[model samples]
Target: MTGAAQIAISGLDPRDRAAIEQLIQRHAWLIDHGKADRIGELFAEDAVLYGIGPDKIGRAAIAEWGRQRAALTERRSRHLQSNILIEPLSPETARGWVALTLYRHDGPGEGLAMPLLIAEYADHYRKAPDGAWLFAERRLSVLFGAA
Candidate 1:
């Protein structure tokens, strides 16, 4: 196993770049705000989200997964993203892999169930005719974690 593997964000862009940036931002926004139901708005209805454990298919299942996860923990989490690499797979499609670091903060003395949960997201983007580049699929892989 590789020790300390990290995600890398690089390359060029101006307009297309913005699409990739928005993709990640939306991900952070939905997760951090505890609005897991809103994930359906970000992904295609038929899109799949992997690494969210079993029953991982379609937007509804993924949204349910997020809700279940949120119920299991009491700590408030903040998702820290870095080392993102977004590549234009095509005019209507793009791919990105980014690093995710989640901080679960409890009260002063509460021990964290997930002190550090680091994963990398494999994302596929599709451009809507209305001009929003939304996620087609998001496959998550755990890079480093305590559980």
Candidate 2:
């Protein structure tokens, strides 16, 4: 198995890992589909997101940012997440990284399309009282195609 997989196997519960993975996937889907108003549902009340313009603190601010982005009807985007690796910090907390590839364009299809950005998301998660995982913090690091 890969190093990250090995660490995940040793450090985190299988179910918790799966739940966190789903949380990550849901974030991508919501953003790609213009469901930004619900973006806060994936995060803790006081979550912080960095590396996307100014840092957004708290769920309200994050949701507002999402609303602003969703207002651009002409701009289209798809966020692909892969190479997810999750590690447990405590029963209630975990951390992980996801390889992010972003494809974006405006108006109709072009001759060819390419990813607009390639990056990794460093994520911290917290388990809620209801046993749901939520993003506590997420920081993006660009590997290429920064704009």
- Models, CA RMSD each: 7.6, 4.2
Candidate with top TM-score is 2
Candidate 1 worst ten-residue window by lDDT:
1-10
- Give the residue spans of candidate 2 off by over 4 A: 1-9
Candidate 1 positional error at 52, Å: 1.4
- TM-score, candidate 2, is 0.88
Give a tens-digit lDDT track for model 2, residues 1-147: 755556556787789888999999999988888787788888899999999999999999998988888787777888989999888877888899999999888776552368999999999999999999999999999899945
lDDT of 2: 0.89
Once fitted onto the true fold, the runs of candidate 1 whose alpha carbons sit more than 4 angstroms away are 1-13, 66-73, 105-114
Looking at model 1, residue 84 earns an lDDT score of 85
- The CA lDDT at 118 in model 1 is 89
Cα displacement (Å) at residue 81, model 2: 1.2
Q: After superposition, how far is residue 88 of candidate 2 from its true place, in Å?
A: 0.2
Q: What is the C-alpha local distance difference test score of each model?
A: 0.72, 0.89
